[model samples]
Target chain A: MEKIEVIFYIEALSNEKKLLERAIEATVESLKGEKSIEVKDISVGDILEDEEEELLKYSGVIEARIVGSFRDVALAALRYSPAVVEVLRPGKMEISARELMEILGDVAVFMANLMEKFGGLAIYPKLDDLPEPKIGYSRDEIEAMIVEDRQILYRFVAEVYDKDEETARVNMAKALSYEGCRINKLTVQKAPNDDKKLLLAAEVLSDFETLFQLMAKYVPVALSIIEPEVIDVTAGELQNALTDISGFAQELITRPLKKQLMDRANTTFRLNP
Target chain B: MREALYWEPLEGGKVRCKLCPLNCIISEGKRGSCRVRKNIGGKLYTLNYGKVSAIGADPVEKKPLFHFWPGSCALSISSVGCNMHCRHCQNWEISQADESFPYLHDMTPEMVVAIAKRYGCESIAYTYNEPVIWYEFVLDTAKLARKEGIYNLLITNGYINEEPFRELAPYIDAMNIDIKAFSDEFYMKIARVPSAEPSRRTAVIAKKDFGIHVELTYLIIPTLNDSEEEIRAFARWVVEELGDDTPVHFSRFFPHYQLTHLPPTPLETIEMAYRVAREEGLKFVYIGNVPGHPGENTYCPRCGKPLIVRWGFKITEYNITDDGRCKYCGEMIPIAGKHAKKRYGAEWW
Candidate 1:
């Protein structure tokens, strides 16, 4: 296992010494067998001494450090530790990629709740540098690993689109285009064709107007793909990619055209059958 | 109708109102977002050209500007319309409506100058509304006021674009710009504007670029934005970006306008905010709106002696020298204009 070192800069020691000690104990317990932890300094030390005197005068030099395994499990455990929690209180606790996905899942559920309470305009999401999930991953894996972890992306969309569902849907659709997926229909229809391949194909058929309207209704789920600039593809590349999804291409092509007939059938039968 | 100030015609029947941030691109018979400037037949016309809706002889300290003119009465005048629609606006009646409102008083620029001179006021404040929205009127009055040896003051939201702000900077002697909150969320939700970051940028520009005496006021509303961390971040930004010498006023927010359901900000919250700002190395942090509070007085950052004693808008005692130095400690304070007993009027808190 590769060794990864983490640092925690603690401040105002005199006011919260007992709390700090408890946090350190919790951190030690959490990191047991995972990696090594050390208390480097208790007093102010030079972090940026050579910089301007004014800058140095404001920030008191006291920082902490924690060393652990670079593996996803160890890193996640270290980040979610109580000591880390106490130190980074009021700010989002930073964690490894795997842990980030878990947090993102929690965030997605939170976004759903926020949307229900305040309406669609309250979801904003952001994503940083992270690899795209494998193309053949299941919907569960995609939702858990890639879709759920990006918080900033959701927060951004929530703030921008707020209550305006169409814009939010459009943004989400645009985001989905990165994963070669398109959200063609956001209905309760869950048939055998309602899988990742079909969903991805459905997304390709989406236009900006339709996507925007969808985003407005649903709370924006902030998901970042492997690439930041996904909209820069040529028209030829867009068409070729959609055609590549061979298994669901025919079904995806007729999905939009079949929506009217499905609605008409339900209305004619009164759903009594 | 008088000729307007700060405008130039464009090529294709468009007149750019170079007054504020909106830079209103006017089509014939259409008005800008401010509702003051209109494009009439390819020419820009200011509707609130000289319409004074509110006029008062208020204590200079009441402008909530402690460093400028210390304690004096300024003849304040304002026209209707604002570039931004802040939800917690205290003066929305004057700021939100157009000049066509029933309360508007028809006073020309010259008449405004005359009224200030008649009231024996040392300065004229273009306040009670966003002065930038009434650009032509403010510019004209400022010109006349400057020529007459009277100072021009502005209590503005500081949301104007750079060009217009620079154009108006020369005339404005002192300003108290409201830095509503540090975050973009607060700006969007509370101010209903795109960027509050611009206001901070403008403050630095006002102080460094234009050399205008600038002070900042932040209303501490409970639950919404009255946190120590937020206030500390704000103070640190001000001290770092604007400078430690820049006086920051942490004003108490009372339930008003659209945000009335929430109770008035507690006095302790204001005090805590003041403490946070002070702890963040801000030299001068004062509390406003809550009268008789100790934070209202200006004290020497080094010696801790009261430099300018104030009660509400009244100056009970003045100990600073002519050069704005403390009498006891001899430390220089960052105040503008000359010191005179006549300027410091007697007003009970």
Candidate 2:
């Protein structure tokens, strides 16, 4: 049988006292029937500068370090360690090298399944008051944890927005009313559109109002356009308009009235002659 | 007031929370990552809205915003829940738990403003937890506080999204943000967050874009992130990105919460880190959590004279003029508000 060496990189010896003990115990148990298993505890002082690279070069050396190992049954014993579960979760590990990567991948999966089935079987030796073991999870487990955590975030956001959307829509509607009023006021002056300036202004105002009203109906969509520095107007100006209108459609729809009126006046003058 | 500040409904009965960096895409009857904002029946509501878990009057320096109102007091308040789950969180009781904690005290925005006025505080600090999680409540309080001529302060982790942060920036007068560490790996392993880029970006926006007086705090833990190289890298980044004038507080960390077994950070490490920062051309670097350390004093960057003497949170000697200039050397300091003789004692809080 080929000999394999495993290594574990334990962080904060004091923080992960319990988890480390459990890993050692499990490794010892799995190799009970094996003939060629070995385990060693390397002190922080013993690690040399080139040890990390040298370990990689050695076929049996694990990335972290072996807290414990058993002769002949080394592989089987290591498989029973609780840390294996964490190493097996989805999105956890990213293997850079192809050689022996497939075997490691299989080991990760097997460990994850074992952990899931026999939860809390591994015991962490206590250093002090810190109770939770600082278990170094496999790449997949870490990714899974991230995903799970994100799910909680998703749930929280959904609840808040879902409840407040109506009020937001109403506020948006009220805020946009100024645009329509501005347009209407412009129209009352009967400004000429000969230079096409008034006509262009009216078109711009009309577009603003239309967009604002549409935004009120669907608050998020409109906000997406306005928030990312995409909107042409300043936030203060937008806020002022929204506050004046008291309804989304009225503020937005009324903004272009003045420009539209000026254009109409210009067209009337040109046609009357 | 509504439950949350920035959120919108989406297709298929989903909602998007824009309050913080998580930008949580919440399905029906779900909550955001902070666990404060929730969606019920496709509507959003803030569970911790107006829930004041902690409140007190604290000195401005206690907020550790050394550049803003040096010798004044601010009414500090905090609700619950944070966007990130930092393993070494000092305020885990409030920032990590759900809404079931009994410490919550319900107070409206009007009440908060009134309390600040009653206490004669120069500002109101939204601290002890990530203030972004309590967006609606903070917004309301800020609006009310502004009306009463009271300034608003935020002591935060700076993990907020750009849009919502910009929206709230106008209402905030000053902020003390935790930069944590310079490495993404440290951030991910320690804070349980994927990236530190968002925090860095938020710090920039808070200082330059919003014009808020920004100070930085970094708690140095032994072995994990107290290396000389890491310290130098962090200090350099602060000087390059946040400018030399920015005050960086390198605080000593005591074992707490999940990281209790680790020994307390050595005072020598803190001193070395401070020296590294100064060598990197940082003008204002202070060491915290150690009492009577000389590093607490603010020395004139040009001339090695102690401008402000501090013992813990207390100011023993204040040598800066009302115009924020050194009285002896006449060199101007970058601090805000009027300077005076140390008016408050160390035990003011």
Please identify model 1 stretches exceeding 4 Å from their true place. A1-273, B1-18, B24-27, B342-349
Question: Model 1 chain B, poorest ten-residue lDDT window?
Answer: B340-349
Question: What DockQ values do the models have?
Answer: 0.01, 0.01
Candidate 2 TM-score over all chains jointly: 0.57
Docking class of 1: incorrect
Per candidate, chain B TM-score? 0.93, 0.96
- Angstrom error of the Cα, residue B102, model 1: value is 1.2
Cα lDDT listed for each candidate: 0.61, 0.61
Candidate 1: residue A21 Cα off by (Å): 65
Candidate 2 lDDT at B201 equals: 94
lDDT of 1 by residue, B120-190 (tens): 88899999988987877788789889999888998988888787778788988999999888788888788
lDDT tens readout by residue for model 2, A1-273: 123344333221212335544544444444444334344433332221323332112111122333221122223323332122111112121212222223323333443344344431112111121111121334453344334322100000000121244343232222222111111111111125432111111111122223333222322110112111212323232222222222322223333553454465446532210
Clashes of each: 37, 79
Worst 10 residues of 2 chain A by lDDT: A151-160
Interface RMSD of 2: 26.8
